[model samples]
Target chain A: MGLVAVTWMNCLGRCLPQKTRFLHTLKGRQSDQILMSPSLASLDLPDTWTPNSSCQSIPDIRKSFNEQTPTVIDGKLMATEIRSKIADQVRQMKKCLGKVPGLAVILVGQRRDSLTYVHNKIIACEEVGMKSVVTELPTDCADADVQNAVMRFNKDPSIHGILVQLPLPQHLDEEKILDALCLEKDVDGFHPLNMGNLSLRGREPLFIPCTPKACIELLIRSGVKIMGKKAVVIGRSNIVGLPTSLLLQRHHATVTIVHAFTENPEQITSEAEIVVSAAGVPSLVRGNWIKSGATVIDVGTSPVEDPSSEDGYRLVGDVCFEEVKKVASVITPVPGGVGPMTVTMLLVNTLDSAKRMLNFT
Target chain B: MGLVAVTWMNCLGRCLPQKTRFLHTLKGRQSDQILMSPSLASLDLPDTWTPNSSCQSIPDIRKSFNEQTPTVIDGKLMATEIRSKIADQVRQMKKCLGKVPGLAVILVGQRRDSLTYVHNKIIACEEVGMKSVVTELPTDCADADVQNAVMRFNKDPSIHGILVQLPLPQHLDEEKILDALCLEKDVDGFHPLNMGNLSLRGREPLFIPCTPKACIELLIRSGVKIMGKKAVVIGRSNIVGLPTSLLLQRHHATVTIVHAFTENPEQITSEAEIVVSAAGVPSLVRGNWIKSGATVIDVGTSPVEDPSSEDGYRLVGDVCFEEVKKVASVITPVPGGVGPMTVTMLLVNTLDSAKRMLNFT
Candidate 1:
């Protein structure tokens, strides 16, 4: 027994050397880039802080930190890269299995916004070499019609992902319909189980909501280190703000959420190293609300009247972009920013679901 | 059409009155007595700030703010109040249903801690007019032995709740065993679905974890207005910290969680109006760590060596109670604090589960 204990101790001594390991995690669809930490300009952090082995290292985290010219986080370029990679995967899968991934959408109304969202998703699916199916029902259709559509898609072997265009006529119970989707095909990541997993530290969500996923992916690809950063999320909407806050928390960032009744919103946002605004109020966030070196991701897509535009209106974000850009180290543009990434992430989730179904992982 | 629109407008005008309504939400089993907010003494916030009609009115919130004599939150007294109420209900339930609620506990090992816990729970059950059953297995018992016991209890009609004491023998699969228990009998609130529902905004969890429930109930009954207040929860343990954070968020408090990786813990806690410490690190938090008017709930019950004491050891919480009592407007004592509330809350959950099973709310 003494000899065995010595042998075990010797084995542990050799195997568990106190070596420092630099860990880098590239997560979600936009798994590639993160822009920089503005204040880390001198590269002093690497020498001063030797974190534990489990820490996720951000490559070139300070590449543009505290630079005179801010590093613009180009979401459009990153989305294109993710799309191409997904497209390549789709091609390979089709060749190997003689089958293509399919995404099915159940739309209840012909509301212009909902129609536009579905069209974008279908387009995104087609771009990635995946098949798309749409089940359109009248706005006045009963809740049973929507549930039947979801059930059909859930049963179909080809349909790996199911999406029910939300704000499904006020008459229908949204929670009931969403909860009914099979856990395997719930690519929206809004199911209570997926959300619970997301919120819990050890649990993992099957799919992260498209908008928040895009925001996190963009941050990762841009090279932002979320660990230990003070992050403030504006708005507590279930889809965007809530999930984004949870995702940030999972990344080890101390996250605070401020909403309608919160006192002194600007003070909170201005103190954060990372600010994600999804308040849906046009131009609510101004330059003064941002910290000098903060990375800001704008998820708001509110329409503001613009007399100069041909359509007499233009899409603006929660942040007053032009002014905030001057103060912020990196900021996502509204039209060219989170919008394209949201559509792209949906395609990514569908492809992932399809891959899992095919034992591809 | 114009006449009908005018009539409809007039009808809407009468239907939506601008009168204020107070909403007091008493959630989960530990439903009464959260002591006072300490710093509300000098200010009559109600007269000064009549918020929107949707605000909840917490009576006498400003009773002893910054007083020389700090408001000591008596958890022992509050727990007694909750237990008696539960006892009365259990009596009424037994009278009506001709059967009493039963709680079945599966204890795998004869560890001193586990034995004491089970003994206490059995005592609590008896005190509340409920039946208790303990399935004791030897230390060397196989995983199947525990699983079978849980399965048996799940099928038993009398058993309304099932609790498998945690930290089961190292050889066992904890997650799998806990997940196997029937979710309906998951009165401990550890099931993934219940946890998931608890994390989600609109969904309701079957049961809130006992410690957090007691903490919230203590705050509510004691009259600390949670809505819009800044709260910082130190520790992110699944059972205590994470669920408590979610509960606070649901109650509209702006919450920040400081965990193992968080830098400047004191700075973060000092900023909060409410601090709930569950770090399980004895004497980790001192008086200087707390803000002048903050309400402190200490959930840490770590045993420390005390040669002077009769037992040669004493249970100390994360906060240095003596020091913190001087600074915090209201604070819970270690022995009489969260400990009693936790056991009382378990009984509350069991009774609630039984009531629910019997078609009573």
Candidate 2:
């Protein structure tokens, strides 16, 4: 593994541009210099270097990175464009068919994040000329009660799409409740049928899960050429990583997935032309781990302390942004990036569901 | 790719015993010395060679191999054992419940291989004490006629399982016919709802597709040690390869699927500790492409011409048996391997279906 890592670093140094080459060389020189500094050389060392020695080089590296250029993906703007197209289609459908698309959101409990997400979805629905209905259940609601709610929505003619916010109360069976949603009405595409259909050759589901779809859309709209490119998706969570890898494969990308148990994730990530980091651990993806000029989609939204913020909290993506922005050619910012696109895709799915159900062109 | 192949051959040679080593060297010496003795010097070849390259070296190789013998897993015996268990359960169920589990097989047109396969399935059902019904449709049968046959089987109270042999005459809508089968009686597990249910993390379908289930069973029964192992499934066909890979992953194997159009499949397959080849392409898997001592489940059954056989044909698996058997620790023979076990699993699924529906355990 160490040999592979060294070989890959050498390869990258040789392959990158002059500016990136200088930075990488300087970073390496400084790190080696710090290790051989007077204070470090005087002390007995363990098998591995200590945090203090590692930290000695960080301040200088941070100063250098701060002056580096930032490459933005403009996810919010791209999402808005997609939403407007969907809104226009919805308006045309309503005008010709005399009916508006409807989305039914089932919220089991009041997880703040879930509440906020649902609220954003409702706003997006309204923005897209679709009707939104919220069915909120108490925290102590029984599994049967939630299932019945889904069943009601499944039978309702007006409800073209249904979404049950995930991480349901511990007592309820998540799989059973989700499976109860009709395949056509399952806008989230978490249902196994949709996934199976997606995995099959020559088959496409009525709806693809939003986050993955949005990730691809964002990349394509940003002019990232994907055909025959190498993509590494770090994480294997069903909702994000695995499906995203499959979607990329569908578009002819050679995708390798690096999960938590993977032997050497950094090496794999560095080999990819496109990297999608969904591992929720903050700052897990470092700048050096990324290939220069590669597009990074940071899907992780970790809440970290920020004294400058009004709430003393800030949402940081999985990538160490300060460092990664210097290396990545294009990257999606944590708050304004994948989050908005996800909500927008949900609106599109709901509208599509309605159009399909009503046979509205 | 060439370097990897050379490394694999060296590893195989080094891993073998002194006798095997001697045999290989002897064969090389004899082939070059005896068969090409006059031409050896002229051809600029080594003097050490043999006529029967492999055969001449076997005795000494076998002696050394015996000293450091690897565990041999008998897939044929294990499959038969599983079938016997299913047969015993079916017998007990029939006696106690007073109703034998029934499987209805719908065969469209007369593809020779399909006919032989369906016939074998019927025989397997009878051997397991389950009722088997075959509905054969003419090659020119209308789509509606096929659908009508499926509907009849779906409506039959005695039938607990329904399976339509694939590649139904090109004119038939395969998806529609598959979807029409009652979800409860979809023993093949191809129904969209069942597939959807199977894809969820915690959700288990009433019936998993037979061949994939058989692959898992073969691995478990052989004590192949799949947990956390890197598995590569070659092919992504819905029926065999894709579902089998997913099932392996569910059992904690880190699975990589190499399908058609996948670049450098040899590199990927060689890295996998366990290989499942179901590409239906004969001799597609080479011995050098497999990791040392890997377990290979060959699910392909392509019939090739053989003048020696009464039928003027012989069945061959996807793996080149002559070459792969020398390297693979355990491998399934084409006809007796996954094929028999697949039919046995179908019986088990039918019986389970009956048990679930009748509530007669």
Candidate 3:
């Protein structure tokens, strides 16, 4: 423990020594120096000093893996709570409006992952007492075919929300197809009009983008404070990183984004109290890079070779989970973390869309 | 000058010494001292470094008191050049296609500034050999009136672009009026559809918002070297600051935005090689706060008391001009700089709209 403290102090001294020297000095002498004092008059300094040490020397403390256990936040559990809340709201809406909310999911191809994801989304919708419809198209379907399906759902009064599974066939224009959905039923909030409204300060989109909203909810459910905290989002992809940063900024968090071409990515990520890693580059963020006790929401879900696994493949996030768990106060695991919550959020969004369409809220 | 430099260094040391030391060492000596550098340096260092001192520090460079410093990139002159280019293109289109580009300017209120701006736009349209039409409505005009005007422009084949002067009457729904304009003919780029397209990566709007475009043109004309430079935008207004930051980012400059709620605003602003201030707060950024030889674009147009002027009012930018001029290498003076370029860019957009409609380009 003493050696760990010493190395942690040295590491912090290397990174933020000038800013932390005064507190570090107090921390270095606190145990021995406080005992020698005639009275316990200066204990307040120890309290403040310890937190700083924990924050600045996260890497060193995490090295003692056996001693420091990682706190695993159950994103699945939090997502279930949200779903239950949405279900309750849906039940009330049904009693009031005599109509149930419905969601239409359009899958363009038979990509196994997309099929599995669509299946899970349908299950989630059913779990939350919402009607779900799935429309499948051939891999070589024309743009007009996709557009026609979207128009059909748009005009269907029973369908309150519409979602198109992503990574559409390479031949199709994804942007044009996504924009074709009626903005009113764009529960996924990927429609250009909804995205534009979300970017504006005073205007709130009828449906907040699902993944970013789920990330925020996960952070709050874990009791991680967000107001006035510094958050860094690594990636600026429109789907996840950019919108996530904007949502965090709306909550008054000072936010910075480090994208692919960003120089010194580690330095920027290290400064954040809340880090959202959506870069999709497996193991891009290591344990040593995070601030001690910082909350990490790992949004990446890349499949990597895992010979030991039954399927011979395993899902991983952008952060080095094994390493990051040691330092992060609350960390979301890759496969069961943001992925499950994402599907669950779609259900919530569908229900909300239904409520809005039925004028239940 | 040496004494000024020393005093400036001392002040920087006292105010943000960690940042100053980190920047000096990082830029001064190109070594990987990532872990050893101060936290301030880690936070304040721009993602990219520009070698030219003047280009890096616009707000702190010495200003030329000589009234005829012709070397300065005159925005007014460049705007004329752009207007002439548009005029030539319009003339060629008329000769080849047998039709002129038409622009419709809708003025909803009697605001003096809006009226003056609209009049200049109409004049610019005429100067470019494009057709111009003006529609005036009373201050108390209903929202339906504005929407009708936009719909009329949408249906009129001859009207290529429709621009409704901003700060519309309070009674009128601004969003509704802006959204009514045909997406293709939305010259102001304020429509949600255009904004959505702008937010998407690699997606270009049919027309960009004028002031931000003008700011970029000003920098380019001055040879400020945007590629891989550190750019900081102070403020996040949808019109100027946010869009300008995005444009700079698109040009491959590492961009950071410092808004009203940003902590350590000076710490972030002073690190950038190029600074764009559009906060609308007078003197929010002081001279010493600027990087030496950086290019400063003052987008704020605030009216301040000036006994020397006959009207007892003077137009000023968000930056404190007299002080910053001594440190900045090149700066856009409030009234003549960005202001003139904005009006001129609007004409350019209108002209482009006309050319597209006329099948000229």
List each candidate's DockQ score. 0.24, 0.09, 0.10
Predicted complex 3: CAPRI docking category: incorrect
Q: Candidate 3 regions off by >4 Å?
A: A1-72, A93-98, A223-228, A325-330, B1-72, B310-312
Instruction: Quote each prediction's TM-score.
Output: 0.84, 0.77, 0.77
The alpha-carbon lDDT assigned to residue A181 of candidate 2 equals 92
The deviation in Å at residue A331 for candidate 2 is 3.7
The global C-alpha lDDT for each of the candidates, from Candidate 1 onward, is 0.73, 0.70, 0.69
lDDT: worst 10-residue window of model 1 chain A: A38-47
Give all candidate RMSDs, comma-separated.
Answer: 10.1, 19.0, 15.0
The lowest-lDDT stretch of 10 consecutive residues in candidate 3 chain A is A46-55
Per-residue lDDT for B313 in model 3?
71
Top model number, TM-score: 1
Residue B99 Cα positional deviation in candidate 3, in Å, after optimal superposition: 3.8
Model 2 residue B230 distance off true place after TM-score fit, in angstroms: 1.3
